[model samples]
Target: MTNNTQSLNSDIAAMAEKEFEGVYGRYRITSTDELEVQRYRLALLLCGVAFTAGLGQWLMIGPTWAWLWLLPMSIGLGLALNWIHIYLRPLHQALKLLWALGCLGAVVMAWSVGTDTMLSTVTAEPAWIWAIGPLFAALTGVGFKEFFCFGRPEAIGLTLLIPIALLGHLSGLMSGSIVMGLLGSAALLLLVLALRKFGMDAAADVGDKSVFAYLSNPQANEAL
Candidate 1:
């Protein structure tokens, strides 16, 4: 067995050498730069805005002021997301983990706070709301890997956040209260992905390439 293992190791090393012989550089599947870093951050920010905006308007502005604050907030979020996408067109990798985690964190917040205000016409089920966090985390993990090439921060943050968001959404949705679950759920997916991708990027661009200043009191700014 020992001899066989040694032989296998030698063969594997030889094969690896042969495979890399023609390659110019090490196959770094995780290499990234400034623009990508910002992109991840951007995704998180957008997720938070949409999540809060969607539920906040539904709950905060009574029938009389329903369209008032919500519409403006929606429009503002849209514009800000777009602006961030364009503004951080040249960033890189150090920020990759930051952005992914940030986005995940944002979605978690959205589910927690936003779901509480969903329409009561058909009351959403706790089971369904409970599922939102895991779903968001899983999908975002894929997106982070697909778009940014790294997802440790995303995976970690999402793991920690899923349960919290589940609790928040569950409290609001209740049982059969809102029939908009299907539609609302779908909307959350889009909101989470887009917001994470663009929101953090624009934010990271604040103050001449300084992520530190950009993140200072981030949650306060996000909820406001």
Candidate 2:
């Protein structure tokens, strides 16, 4: 009877140890997943800013309001860049280089459009074409960076925005602002869905920990 009891005790201890190891492994994986999810959330916020800006532009809002969009957009961009630097320290320089290039390209594109506007023969419609290159480059660059940090689904989704906007432009069904607004809206929708899933997953992790804590705590049962 004593031998049987000792063997049973050993078995239970081994089992508990194995379970703990599995849980620790899962915790590590979940932590990594949570970081990616947060990064995606930031991306979503940036998309929201873009959507607002595009909509505001479409409505021909005041320049002051248009400039205000830049503040949020800049904040989002800074957060994204900082997050990338923190999590991907090795590629920080490369990402910064890409961002600087994108910004420069956008500035040049804007300057070209302004110049076109000043020309007597240049039409407003044709001036928009100059902006397309910078837009595509920026979107593709962002998707590429995200591909490294997140996964293919997000990267593909972000990249698709460029082509979708381009198609809208080529189709002539809507103006550039409307096309941008539509793309931003679509991106925002995807971000919201992804964020909800991430949030639920994180909540589950917390719930699991709570259950584990309750099960392990002698005081918890006494209190209950």
Candidate 3:
């Protein structure tokens, strides 16, 4: 190693030694590790479902009047984001299970909405029901945060979906429910597969967790 790198390595090794020895290591600047983004994804899905559940209370309040409380949920969600700095990720098997469930739900929701509102939509139930596509997509995505992995497929899929989602929603205003349902289902299923395949996989080390052993120790991932 060069003089500078050797010096830095010496320093880090010394620090690790001290911590392992129970020395005055409290003040040491150890690596600040955060949980994987997948963990936050679980919270995100809960948040989406929770926020939507508020719609029940919104129901009691009736109509556009419920917009007043939107700020509270928005702010609460903002504060929650701060916790991204600290968390422990779950195992890969769990992510796969969640992925399977999300895909199944996407298929069911699409089929149901398509069948129910096929003839006539735009009224209270259909409008809300049709919202399920994005709601499912968002919540499913929230359960599995794969922003990086989703780049190419998701970008293209969403690019293909947006105009259609908007147009379908808007068309509920003029076209029969059958047309709206058909259009909505067609676009949304595309998003479903792309997201399921890419978003569900376990990603790289999520946040900035230090890997002293992985970096310095020779056999960290030797088995894998």
Per TM-score, the best of the predicted structures is 2
For residue 200, what is the lDDT in candidate 2?
A: 47
Worst 10 residues of 2 by lDDT: 115-124
What lDDT does the true structure give each of the candidates? 0.40, 0.49, 0.40
List ranges where model 1 is wrong by over 4 Å: 1-32, 62-122, 130-133, 139-162, 165-224
Query: Please, what are the lDDT tens digits per residue for candidate 3 over residues 17-42?
Result: 32222122232223332233444444
Top candidate, metric lDDT:
2
Runs in model 3 deviating more than 4 A are 1-31, 35-46, 76-167, 171-224
TM-score of 2: 0.45
Ranking by TM-score: 2, 1, 3
RMSD of each: 16.8, 14.4, 15.6
Error of 1 at 138 (Å): 3.9
Residue-level error in angstroms, candidate 3, position 216: 23
Candidate 1 minimal-lDDT segment of 10 residues: 21-30
TM-score of 1: 0.29
Please say which candidate is ahead in TM-score: 1 or 2.
2
User: What tens digits encode model 1's per-residue C-alpha lDDT throughout 183-220?
Assistant: 24534554555445543432223323233333344673
